[model samples]
Target: MFRDTSHLVVEELSRTLERIDPAQVQAFVDALLAADKVFVVGVGRVLLALQAMTKRFAHLGIAITYVGAITEPAITPKDLLVVGSGSGSSLFPLAIARKAKAIGAKVVHIGSNPQSDMKDVADFMVRIPVRTKLYLDDEIDSRQPMTSLFEQSLLIFGDIVAKMIIDERQLDLKGLWQHHANLE
Candidate 1:
């Protein structure tokens, strides 16, 4: 009767977060805040993570968009593209990161592979290793089942960074609520 695997997963996440280098995280945050604009991308559930980030930045009056958004293609060389590629093995994100670099855009990859091709082309990288219960289903999302440990991490990590930014700026609930969805 004592059996669901919450503690194990939480412990794993704590270790994963602990592995993140604080200095690098700060530098990354500073670089992101300095960007002229921010665009984020990820395939599948990862895209949801990017959307979470978009909402937070929207509250701060900063420009942020997901690659799938109507305005994303307009992101230019002066902008920053944050790709949430947890595997760093994705061909599409790697290609985009390379293309983004060629055009003078700044690329930030949040993933587990620091030595991956995407990282080689990225201006910044924050690696968060994830162990999925399965693999191929994550790409095509088949019936074998899927889970979004990486996606969850991206959302959680993005919120962490957003909270840090909000605190640093002394922003209050009133400030954040100004950006909340009134239509909802």
Candidate 2:
């Protein structure tokens, strides 16, 4: 049962990711590379995914932080705020996105529902188009429970963008090791 379930989950992830527009991913990468700093916000599992992305971006020498961290710096016009919420209406992320926009910072929303309130706040969106709690018509159906597929896809998408950044900058792979947490 474990093996069968694993295969099914992988298959679902593949389908969900395949539907995402490559152009959207490229735009997100461009924004990340252009930003002086990147701030991420989300809740629950989505926040965990963004945190992973934050660490990976740090490894690439990009200035990144998860919102609400004790050391989080003030966002400026040149910085970017990345909000991850499968439904795009998670209260905390939505509020943070709005605040970031008010501060003149660019906001990029990564979620399944493009039509959610986040649409008005985000400067742009890199949609995952997976099954969210809202069950929007265009979202890809998932057999997994709740928003698992979306969270899993978001995690993988972050890694994909990190790899794209590495390739675009032609960074030395060996040098990235220096950025990994030494205490861990």
Candidate 3:
């Protein structure tokens, strides 16, 4: 039963991944590369994923900070904020995205809902078509529980974006190691 469930999860994820548009992802990558400073924000499990991406960005030598970090600087017009919300209606992320836009900072929203109110606040968006609490009407029932698919997809997408930048910048493992924390 465990083997069958694992296979089902993979199958569901494969189908969800197929719906993602590479062009949209490329636009996000281009924005990340162009930004002087990058800020990331999310909530709960989504925040965990963005936090991991923030660490990877640091290792990749891109200036990045998780929103609300003590050392984070004020965002400016030249900065980019990446916000992930599976529902896209989460108040915290939406509020930050709104503030970023008002501050003249570019915002990239990574979520599953195209029609989410957060879409209006974002300057750019990468839609990941997966099941979330708000999107449970999906024809294919997900093996993973509520919003797990979307959260998983967000993590994978973040990794792919980081890899693209690492490759384009010709950053090798040795270079990444240079940025890794010595104490960790």
TM-score of each: 0.85, 0.98, 0.93
Q: Candidates sorted by lDDT, descending order?
A: 2, 3, 1
Error of 3 at 80 (Å): 0.5
Superposed by TM-score, candidate 1 places the C-alpha of residue 33 at a distance from the truth, in angstroms, of 0.7
Ten contiguous residues with the weakest lDDT in model 1: 136-145
Instruction: Compute the lDDT of residue 87 as modeled in candidate 1.
Output: 68
How would you encode candidate 3's per-residue C-alpha lDDT over 1-184 as one tens digit per residue? 9999889878887887788888998999899889999999999999999998898888888899999999999999999999999778999999999999999999999987778898788987898878777745643347688888877877777788888888888878776788988996
Candidate 3 stretches greater than 4 Å from native = 136-141
TM-score of 3: 0.93
Better of 2 and 3 by TM-score: 2
Better of 1 and 2 by TM-score: 2
Residue range with the least summed lDDT across 10 consecutive positions in model 2:
131-140
lDDT value, residue 29 of candidate 1: 83
Q: What would the per-residue lDDT of candidate 1 be over residues 86-130, giving only the tens digit for each residue?
A: 667687777777777788889888876666678678887886755
Model 2 pairs whose backbones collide? none
What would the per-residue lDDT of candidate 2 be over residues 1-184, giving only the tens digit for each residue?
Answer: 9999999999999998899999999999999989999999999999999999999999999999999999999999999999999899999999999999999999999999989999999999999999888888988898899999999999999999999999999999999999999996
State each model's CA lDDT, in order: 0.73, 0.95, 0.87
Candidate 2 displacement at residue 46 in angstroms: 0.3
